[model samples]
Target chain A: MELPQKYSEQELVWLLKQRNEQAYSYLYDHYSGALFSIILSIVKEEELATDVLQEVFIKIWRQISLYDTTKGRLYTWMLNVARNTSIDAIRSKGVKNSRQNQELTENVYEQAGSAEMKTDAIGLRKLVHTLKDEWKILIELSYFEGYTQDEMAKMLNIPLGTVKTRLRSGLAALSKIIKP
Target chain B: MNTQEYIESGIIETYVLGMTDAIESAELEQYCREYPDIKLAVTAFEATLEQHALLNPINPPSTIKVQLFESLKDEFVHPVFMSAPTKQSAKVFDIKPFLKYIAAASIILLVISGAMNLYLYTKLSNSSAQYQAILVEKTSLQANNQLIQAKALDLFNSMQMMTDPNMLKVSMPGMPGKEKNYATIFWDTKSKDVYILPNKLPQPTLGKQYQLWAMVDGKAVDAGMIGDCAGLCKMKNIPSATMFAVTLEKKGGSSIPTITEMYLAGKVS
Candidate 1:
């Protein structure tokens, strides 16, 4: 399908604040893909991810007024909201129980299976594989899983400094693969 | 301070990943304002991370959009009725009674003139209330019209800026972890005028403000202090500038920009 006409970030934000329905529709059409991917990366379950995506858009509509452009871009703010909402969904008892019953060792991306792997996903998996296990795990937990540095440190039984260094190195390595 | 060592310290990367604690993030923003190199490193790292996130876009099922719009239908419709003038005036002016009073007054003008006057007074008060409702609606409509006109003008100006060949567009992406943060600078070199396109920057702390700097000959010249983070803002014109940057400073701006507090900058090409 053809994409909606592109709007500059400022214009899109202004239109949103004005409660323009077209802008909202455009926002959903353009951003739902990336946002759904982010939510799925964190929540793992397709059903739960769909629910979280719905909640995220509702929150965006209700709270678009609270979005201060000075603070960040619309997408960045929306991404944070999506990540937080997805994390909250995962924390619920039903999701947690299902997650535990599944393979505890499989990360969300791997559990998604190879059928879903398009060229982009293939590239991402390849880039991720190029990193050391320590770096890869850190990237997965922090970036995809939405774990904070302190949380990653505690979860991995490592010092905060190691988490920081490893995250930097991991990103630096991934940067090379993606950019090169 | 050794900026290279600081960049190598991996703090910029950590910040870009959104892993930094609040205090650490605030400190990094301060350093970015004071040092250009640190700010540049942060911007580069942020760009890389943003790229990484963009790689795995997956379209959600099409059914979701239909479901979402259906759910929001009430929200859009309900607000219109709520804000609309309640149709209470419809019951206020019962035309039968009004016509009866007028007909009765035409005959026996002397006998019932006093009673008629009393009845007319009551009718006048009722109509006044109806008139008040109409007046309020008129004012609101006027205000809405004005708002629409203003928005149209803003869009027109933005379009003009985009199409004008004399205007040089500079993309000033946010520093470090603020990769999503950005502002555009439109320089009409022929006119020597600079305009900042509305952008997202973190709101400065109380008693602090963002100042624009035009870098010429390695010296930072104060362009102006930005007042609003929204809408297009005109900044002080310079004969020429090789690069442009923004810095957080004391409320009114400082004589020289705090290099470490620099939020964004771009070289003019």
Candidate 2:
């Protein structure tokens, strides 16, 4: 039976390790929206994004034991997985041809709320909007596109040091607003 | 850079965002473990990223969740990779041949188990029968022992009676035709009790019994009948009897002595 109540992160992790079906349902119910948003931001299309999301969940199930609680929160680790899997899907040969015409930078600054998704992150959206386009693009490229510092530096025709600085300042500004 | 400068350098941010390469991520993790402030900053950025991700919610189509869960159900029985339907076709092999072998092995095991059960049941019944026979034999032996014990006690009492000074043993000789048959009478003078031992009496014909008679005063008094007695038979009490005799009569004794039928005669001293 699906639990009606919320589980603490530790409780959820314990249930997940035991491979509890209810925990899997709870996990899907609780985090799929956020994860789907991240996946869609990368893959851009709902059908391909849906496939990427499913692959992300299967990876999470198979690699749940590898989750190191000492490093980060469950959502943070899952965000990483979702971003990586979506990037892999688009990078694969099948997606590259169909998606060649669309520029990656176009969707980099695209607001999730502007799409069909509900605007629950209006507060965070305003805070992100206040950030300079240069700083915002760096965070989006690395966070959503799963680009490394070197890759972002080369793509933007900038030094690797500038890419690292912008990403740091962008996260610092967002962290202040979100936590404040 | 030092740990504080390192914390401020945005490396932890890249690490939390999954943008760091393997070398950069591993080095940052080592620093995070070594320094609590670096660790705290890492956790804070990770939390910030989580909150940001949660804020940007886009629900996937409802069908994917159902399909994902349905695919996961197969994982419990055998490990299944993601989207295996396409990959599995190349690896499909037939298992129909092994089914008959499995069925045959199962049937053989069933037969062996049934036969063992029947054999054990027969052995148990045989043991039970043997146990019952031993019990019956024990009871019969116990009954025979009790009978022998009673006989020994009787013989011991008879010995005591013969040795008693107040007892007078009277010898009875068989009549003219039955000269070989003889008997004895043990008469206790003090108790006035009469007992007879038909020591060598022949088995009488059907419907006839050998009986004892005591002559008291001038009249013959009827003692008691002796019927197939192997030991001392207590006859009727006689007071000052001068003679004792036995004769074959009917199954029960006759009221008067049949002189022609007399088999033994004795004079008491």
Candidate 3:
């Protein structure tokens, strides 16, 4: 069953404090698949991805008591958990280096947004596909690859200022395309 | 700033793209917190980014989700794990096993328990068999003892025929030189029978019976003969005896006792 709408994020946190199994299961249903997909994308190995997913949940459970509503929303906190956990998986194993991962991200640049995915994600991928090439590359570097502007500048052999401007310019163009 | 004024700066979009620095994010967060429109703008932008990832989402194999869920469910207490806030939280949880591990452990426990049960059953049977063997041997020994008891009872009944109702017991005391040596004879004058018990007498010198005589007024009359009853030292009923004596003599009975050979004598009193 779906989470009841009257239960605000505050009420949900209260329910979680009670250590309600229903709340935990409800939370997982909404986020586990998505978080697992993100982790598997970064970790690649199914076994390690599974491990990281469990670690993320354990962390959430242990630190839920510390969650402050004033800091930001629950979604932002959860995304941080997911991103940090995936990165931690690589570091803890000491096997996967980001430099190595960058080399293997696949020539996905050309066909990245063109996959005929069967999920509801296909529509969103189509929106990203609708963007122009020059803009899409910078977006991918900043978002998917999690590169800093200075790193992007270094990789492309451009001035840091130029990388920042193009990235800002490109995102502006893409936001327009997304809206109307 | 108007939409174009804000859009023209390209900073809001950068803030939206999350490529902004700490100062920039703080500035944006402040502006978003102050202005409802700016917060909406940020939410909309972040939502769009999330959507893009969703659109191109790499749907991992269905098996991967199942694997991830199951693995998390089963937690072995490896040192790598951090405990929950309480010890009680660490327990009271089910250990859902990985599929590969579940298969292996099931096979192992089945084999071990099966072998143990079989060994126990065999031991029980062997112990029962040994107990039954001992019981059979006990039954046979009891039967043999019963047979021996029946034979002893038969012998006792046959000896009843030798009893004399009117018999008188005569004690024969040893002579002066041989005290502690003695014999007894029972005389049934009505039946003219006598019974001798020469158990207290020492071994005779030759193959001889201790002769008995009836002496009336110092006159000797032949009564009967006595012979050793081997080591059993027992004798049965005979004809008669007025007085009895044991003496060393020849193999057969004599009508009178040799005075030098008389070992014991007694009067009918």
Candidate 4:
């Protein structure tokens, strides 16, 4: 049977688990650049970063079955793989020259699962740009931090209901902007 | 309480964001099982969030995609190895590392190499040293043989001279401590050449060697020292003499033989 053209994140994951090359190709062509930037930023060595990038995809290929869409997006899962791999590479290469500016350097991407997102992926920055600040923050925290709304609420000092309300509205608004 | 009201209230967003307290997520899960609409709203909220992240996903360079594609292709193609039909096919294939064999082989190789080198070095040195010693021995043996041949010819020629009219022949009697030793003397009086038969003696201790003295009226005159030749025995020269005596003495022989120490005597006629 021909693979479906319109695949949800879960649907594409299922196809990848079943060893679908078309789905893998689509994911790569669409998302590799954003992942590359994350990897490059974390691992300064270009060649080593490239190796880690290759490993990230290989792991994605072999371990796609482990991804649970109920827990997070495929991009979030993939980005975590890349980030962890790069950090591991940094340790393995014994990189001691990194600046000590830990907190100051944390952009949305510095969040473990944050850069794993596709905001700039497939040019989603344009769509995400149309979103208000609250949506961006919600997206940055939830998807990036791997935070539950409870965690987000605690972190932002907002009520749980407010965190929930903001996330739902932010997502719904994103749908209209991107899909519309 | 109404499921539709709950859906409209956007409780699904809290579920997707995991912002709701544990009891709330459990309640939503219960609702999802009870009504499909609640599940639909939940998936809808999750889908938009996922899609948004997907749109902004961190894509690595093209190489990652290529590597990913290869793995995907492997799953698609599932190529089999040539020799190994199944990795689990054989007992050999199933076997873990044979470190024992590797260790044994390496050890044996190292030992054999070490021993062989040691043996070769010893053998080479032994052969070279033996060859050098043999060369030295052969050279000395050749020189000794040549000296003996020349002495034999001299003894023969000197005997012929003794029969000549101008030469005198004398026999020396072994006397006193030299009772076992006797010698013949050929004195070429005209030429003042004296050849003694068997000019040989054993080694002496410190300050001692045999001295040959020419006797004139029983007083000794110096001839030369003797009995310490390191080379082979041969006939040797002496001066023409009225009489001959040998005595043991201090090294280089005293200016004259100490008469009390005379070991042998001969009268030349």
Best by lDDT: 2
DockQ of every predicted complex = 0.23, 0.26, 0.08, 0.14
Expressed as tens digits, the lDDT of each residue in B1-269 for candidate 4 is 58777776646654554445689878888888889888777666555655555555554555555655665564675433323222223122232436999778877876897798789878977987787788677777877876885565455445446556766767766677767766566666666766555443334578887677777665677766665232222233555457887777888778867778766788877
What is candidate 1's TM-score for chain A?
0.73
Native interface contact recovery, all models: 0.42, 0.73, 0.21, 0.39
Q: Rank the candidates by TM-score, best first.
A: 1, 2, 3, 4
Q: Is the docking of candidate 4 incorrect, acceptable, medium or high quality?
A: incorrect
Number of the candidate with higher DockQ, 3 or 4: 4
TM-score of chain B of 1: 0.54
lDDT of 4 at A47: 83
- Model 3: how far residue A5 lies from native, Å: 8.8
Candidate with the greatest DockQ versus the true structure = 2
What is the fnat score of candidate 3?
0.21
**lDDT by residue (tens digit), candidate 1, B112-142:** 7659767987897799788888978887897
Q: Which runs in model 4 stand beyond 4 Å of their true positions?
A: A1-56, A67-99, A102-136, A145-155, B13-26, B44-60, B69-269
Per-residue lDDT tens digits for candidate 3, residues A1-180, read 123423457766766664554566566665666666667655557788777777887777668888776655565566567666776675556444435666665643333323322223222233544567666566655654456777777666779888777777777776766662
Tens digit of per-residue lDDT, candidate 1, span A122-172: 324446656788887777666655668887777777999888888877776
Indicate the TM-score of model 1.
0.52
TM-score of structure candidate 3: 0.41
Q: What's the lDDT for residue B166 in model 4?
A: 64
Residue-by-residue lDDT tens digits, candidate 2, A5-70: 467898788768767677788899989998888777667777888999999999999899999987
Cα lDDT for residue A44, candidate 2: 72
